[model samples]
Target: MVKLRLKRYGRKKLPSYRIIVIDSRNKRDGKAIEELGFYNPITNETRIDIPRVLQRLTEGAQATRTVQNILDRAQLIAKEEN
Candidate 1:
């Protein structure tokens, strides 16, 4: 199964992540099928490819809980903007 999840990067104790689409069988930081967004927890900043995220979701990509929350917030913000 394909899933949407965070892949850690950046320096220790100052982590950032890429929101990625990857196979379930792979490791946490394994190669991804596609990259959909970026998250920086320390700064509470997010940069998402909303359209591509919607496309992947429609195609049956399941997201992790944290990613789901992020997506929810992003979608809400997007709705407000439009």
Candidate 2:
């Protein structure tokens, strides 16, 4: 199964994440099938590829809770842009 999830990376105290499409059984930081966006919790910042994310979702990619929340925020941003 393919899942949309976060891949953690950065310094010890300051962490950032790349939202990626990866295999469910793979390690958290394992090789990703595709990178969809990035998030920084400290700054509450997010950057998402909306079209690609929608595409992946339509194709049956399941998102974890955190990722789903990020996507929800992204959706609101996208709606406001237009």
lDDT of 1 by residue, 1-82 (tens): 9999999999989999999999999999999999999999999999999899989999999999999999999889889999
At residue 54, what lDDT does model 2 achieve?
Answer: 89
Instruction: For candidate 2, write residues 15-52 as lDDT tens digits.
Output: 99999999999999999999999999999999999899
Error of 2 at 57 (Å): 0.6
- What's the lDDT of the predicted structure labeled candidate 2? 0.96
CA lDDT of 42 in candidate 2?
A: 98
- Cα-based lDDT at residue 24, candidate 2: 98
Q: If scored against the real structure, what TM-score would every candidate get?
A: 0.94, 0.94
| Colliding residue pairs in candidate 1 | none
